[model samples]
Target: MAIIFEEKQNIFHLQANDTSYVMQIIRDGYLSHLYWGRKINQYNHSNKLQFVDRAFSGNPYPSIDRTFSLDTLPQEYPGYGNTDYRNPAYQLQLDNGTTVTDLRYKSHVIYKGKPALEGLPAVYAEDKNEAETLEITLEDQIADISVLLTYTVYEQRNVITRTAKIINTGSASVDLKRALSVNIDFRDADFDFLHLPGAWGRERHIERQPLRSGIQSVESRRGASSHQHNPFVALLRKGTNEDNGEVFGLNLVYSGNFLAQAEVDQFNNTRVSLGINPFDFNWKLNPGESFQCPEAVMVYSHEGLGGMSRTFHDLYRTRLCRGTFRDKERPILINNWEATYFDFNADKIEQIAKAGKELGIELFVLDDGWFGKRDDDTSSLGDWFVDKGKLPSGLEDLVNRVRNMDMEFGLWFEPEMISVNSDLYRKHPDWCLHVPNRTRSESRNQLVLDFSRKDVCDEMIKMVSDILASCPITYVKWDMNRHMTEIGSAILPPDQQRETAHRYMLGLYRVMDEITAAFPHVLFESCSGGGGRFDPGILYYMPQTWTSDNTDAISRLKIQYGTSLVYPISSMGSHVSDIPNHQVHRYTSLDIRGDAAMSGNLGYELDLSKLTEKEKEVVKKQVSTYKEIRKLIQFGDFYRLISPFENNEAAWAFINKDKDEAIVFYFRLLSEANSPFESFKVKGLDPLKSYKVENTNDIYGGDELEFVGLSVPTELNGDFQSHVWRLKALK
Candidate 1:
């Protein structure tokens, strides 16, 4: 069993693969966090957890002398307004307006299976033996609020998924102001904070800094898990690296506005919390009403950042993400966005598709501008029907033509957005999210649909569903171009205005659920102007995310690397686009772009028809090579050979599940005058076997290569140069 209860000590020992999390329900009815780290044979922290009265911090139970002071002790689920100053895990506002909750342990149940959140996306237990979940119910009688904290421990993944269910059990109503899904208090803050922060074009840049004494967090208030900040944060010991050291990581499985924070209190205790952002969020829970928070996946690694990352990769890749496309090999697709932008019509699209088909591309996707007089980003976002003017025969004919060319077809849609000049908007202007008197701020010449309203979401879902059902569309690239601005919903009352952002996300998720469920055979790829919505929440619906808007090989190194810190490479939608790169306008070798793109679900975003015979040959070779190694790149264990953050050249290795094959990609970003041939050791190799490099006749023992290292091509010397080395082992 993954979860074990020692009733005598009131300690619950939750084991997830190589890690163990211990917590205790104390004599005073407080559930205190005991320990979370590498597995131990037994837990003996109950005696050491005695709490004392602190000078400034107040206690929760004054009558229970010094058994445990909520102010000083670590907790499993710390509530707000009980005098504990650290950022709270849960908070409630009563009808009389007292925003206090004194929650105590009520009861708990341990089960073999994990329960699904009411209406949210979460990681599930694929098999009963894979994990066990424990539900700890805490309540405050006077406030009549009960918070159910659930912990699911994966036996082989070293991961713990946490969530909370807040219910108003009394006759009176209460407003939930800050109901974070997960929080864990560490005894000390002896770690560094690692986060991904960047702007629109450069999303998910790895940023690591020392944990200061105050609060350090990554959040998004733009009504999304914004491009500026991702919903992932990690704390590792000072010297932790990709391969070594203890690291604790948390990722919120939510796509909307969220907050992931770690606050080191004066006492040096660090409390890490994650969930829907409380900034512009509030939920009113009437009697018998409950609010289910999104799940927070927590992973603990004694083997360093890579271990932590792989744990997440394993769990999320198989359990968290659902759909027919989850583990299957994705199509080698060519999208027309970068190839033709918004100028493409049926003829232009067919030209590109024919070229891609000749080069063995499996799919051709008609990107933006195929619908509703959409020549540019300025108008016609919500109109899902094909533009008869562009495709004279309509979408069905184009889809059939692509299929006849032996290629699958995909289309893009920005269903969450509406143009001010669009027919949908002209008829129902108020349907767009806005305040009666506030200026309706527009982004990309479009307004965000008030998805928080069920009517609006239903319409969009119907439109999207109808379009997908109309044709044999194999994939969908669902894009949300803008973020919330007005912070108001036309159908929401004044007091419920704060609920707009999260409710909008909820509605958006509902639409996704409806569409994805209905189209079980279709593959969905979530995109928010590229990678803005690349989060676990969206990953639940769409297995892969467009890693970034910038497909430049040089820029993608950093973006994909940082994204890999939390997401598996398979989940990244990386493509080889034309040069000078679309976003950066920096010319890169076509082969180098292919090498970088091969690290993800490889595809192309260039005009294949424009390629010279030589360039076409190179792309053909790239596609064939990708097909040869796609299995290794997609499902194999990933190891970071070198970080782009600290080097002029980047390197990484992908080893197959059986350790029989390994592919190493080396990218040279700069030319150095006297730099010796780059040589580096590798990982995840069987020491006893002899492996042969495919390109060269060189053969070496696995240990010799993994320890002494594989050498780069010393003869190659140029900026933006790259080489792919695949090793086949002989038993």
Candidate 2:
């Protein structure tokens, strides 16, 4: 069993394969965090919770002991206003208008397997032996509320998932002011705060800072988990690097507004909290009503950030993400967004599809401007019907033409948005999210649809379902171009107006659940103006996401590398787009672009017919080479040898599950004159094996390549140069 409970000491120990998390119900019923790190064979009842009577740290339970104060104790889930002044895991406003809450440990249950969250995305236990769960109930008798804190430990993974369920057990209604998923108190603040933060085109750029004496956080108030900040944060020990030292990471499995923060108190104790953002948010829990927070995943790695990343990749790729495509090799698709954009006819699209087919592309995706009377981003967003002006005959005809070339067909849809000029918006102006009489702000020339309404969600499901059922669509590129603005639902009550954003996410998940389930054969790839909503919640429904809109090879080195910190390679929709790149407008070689793109699900987003014969031949070989290693690239274990953020040269490797075949990609942004000989140690290779490099006479023992180093090709020249080395274990 992964979980063990000691009744005498009131301690709960969650032991994963390589890590352990220990906590206990201490004096006054407060659950104190004992330890979290490398697996401890036996905790030996180590009590790290110390009591210090500081000047202002109030002692809530002075009758038992005057020095016992929550402010100084390491806590699991803490509440504010009652001695502990730190950020709370949850807070409730009672009927009497008091905001203080005192929760005492009631009881706990240990069981096999994990239970799914009521209406949220979470990691699951596929088999009973895969995980164990513990539920600790804490009750606030005065408020008549109970918070059920659940912890699930994956038996073979160094991961622990946490969630909280707040139930209003009294007859009176309770207003939940804040409900965070999980919280942990560290003994010291000596760590570096690592987060993925960036804007639209440049998503998930890793940034790390040393912990100071205040709050360091990454939050999204933009409704969708905006491109500004991902729902993940990590803490690295002082001297930790990519390969060694301790790292603790947390990720929220939610797509809506969320908060992940680390607060270093004046006493130097660090409190980490993650869950739904309490900003502009409130939930009214009536008697017998319960509110469930989204799940927060915790990864403890003594092997540093790389070790932390691999654990998340393994757990999320196999457990958190669901559907048929989760384990399957994604097809090499060619999207026409960059190729034609809002200017394309059926004949033009067919030409591009034919050109791609001749070069070994397996799927052809027709991007925007195919629905409603849409000519540009300004109109007909909610209209899901095909535009006869663009298709001439309808979606079915175009789909048939693509399928005729022995290629799959994919279509793009932005179902959660509406244009003021759209027919649907004309019929129902209140359909878009807005505050009464407030100017409905527009982004990308569109407004976010009020998905909080069942009417809106039903219409979206119907419209999207009709299109999929009408055509032989094999894939879908679901896109949302705008974030929420004036985010008030016309149908919700005034008191519940603050619930608009979260409700919208719930409504979207419901719609996606229904539509994707109905069209089980369709391979769905979620996009929020490209990588805006690329989070675990969306990945639960759609297995993959468009990594970014900026397909520039050099720019993508950082984007892709940072993304690999939490997401699996199979979940990144990377493509070789036209250069001068559409977003950055910086020209890079075709070879480097392909090299950058091949690290994920390979695709192309350019007008293939416009390529020269030489470029076409190069693209054909890129496609063929990608096909030969698609499975290895998508399913293999990923290793980040060198960070693009740290060096001008970036390198990464992928080794198959059998540890026999390996592929390494090295890229340089700019050629350095007389650069010193470059070699870097690789990882995850069997030391006993001798491997031969493909297309060369070079052979070396795996130990030499992994320990001594793998050399960069000295002959390569010019800026944005790249090389791919394929190694095969020799008998």
Q: Ten-residue segment with the worst summed lDDT in candidate 2?
A: 45-54
- After TM-score superposition, the amount by which residue 180's alpha carbon in candidate 2 deviates from its true location, in angstroms, is 0.3
Q: Each model's C-alpha lDDT? A: 0.88, 0.92
Q: Model 1 over residues 186-296: C-alpha lDDT tens digits?
A: 988899999999988899998988888989988999998989999999999989998899999999999988899999999898998999888878898989999999999
Q: List the residue pairs that clash in candidate 2.
A: none
lDDT of 2 by residue, 1-731 (tens): 78888888888989998999999998768889998889988898565566666867888766756687788888888998988988888999999999999888999999888999866788888897789999999998988999999999988999999999999999999899899999999999989999999998999999999999989888999998989999999999999998899999999999999999999997999999999999999999999999999999999999988899889888878997788888989999999988888999999999999999999999999999998999988899988888999888888999999999999999998899899999999999999899998898888889999999999999999999999999799899999887888989999999899989989988999999999899888999999988999899999999999999989999999999999999999999999999899898899999999999999999999999999999999999999999999999998999999999989889999999888999999998898899998999888889999899999999999899878998887998889999999999997
How high is each candidate's TM-score? 0.98, 0.99
Worst 10 residues of 1 by lDDT: 59-68
In model 2, the Cα lDDT at residue 324 comes to 81
Report how far off residue 520 is in candidate 2 (Å): 1.2
